[model samples]
Target: MWSFSTYKDKRYWILLITAIIILVLFAVFTPDYILEKTNFVPFSMLIFIVLFWSTYHLWKYFGDKKKRNNTDDSCDL
Candidate 1:
């Protein structure tokens, strides 16, 4: 039952697109000497993990804040 519509937030899409662009740019623009010295697989994996972790935490934090605001507004009535 998984579908693209499951993620309706524009912010989520923006983050995904930005991360992809960053990874692509990093691979293309980095100097050959630097790449030759390091294992690109591990480095790219680390970067991807960091990006996903930060994005998840940020989304959770903002989602909680939004829920709290809704509750507060309801209480005002």
Candidate 2:
């Protein structure tokens, strides 16, 4: 059976905490530098990570769509 387990999903919370910590650290210690280096390091990495995940999901979604379309076409024939 499928289920949601907090212990098994702890990484989600850990990632959230890590993101918060990184933001706080950047804000406190390197705000200007972060803003300046927005194209290179931490900020860019965050953006790239999000975009990469989004692209993966977009690819998966389109794959599902194509599969559904093929199934429907075959059924119609």
The candidate maximizing lDDT is 1
**How many residue pairs of model 1 clash at the backbone?**
0
Residue by residue across 17-48, what tens digits does model 1's lDDT show?
A: 88889889988998988778768768877889
Question: Least accurate stretch of 10 residues (summed lDDT) in model 1?
Answer: 1-10
Candidate no. 2 TM-score: 0.48
What's the true lDDT of residue 72 in model 2? 89
User: Which regions of candidate 2 deviate over 4 angstroms?
Assistant: 1-40
Separately for all candidates shown, the number of backbone clashes (residues 3 or more apart, or on different chains) is: 0, 0
User: Global lDDT for candidate 1?
Assistant: 0.79
Best by TM-score: 1
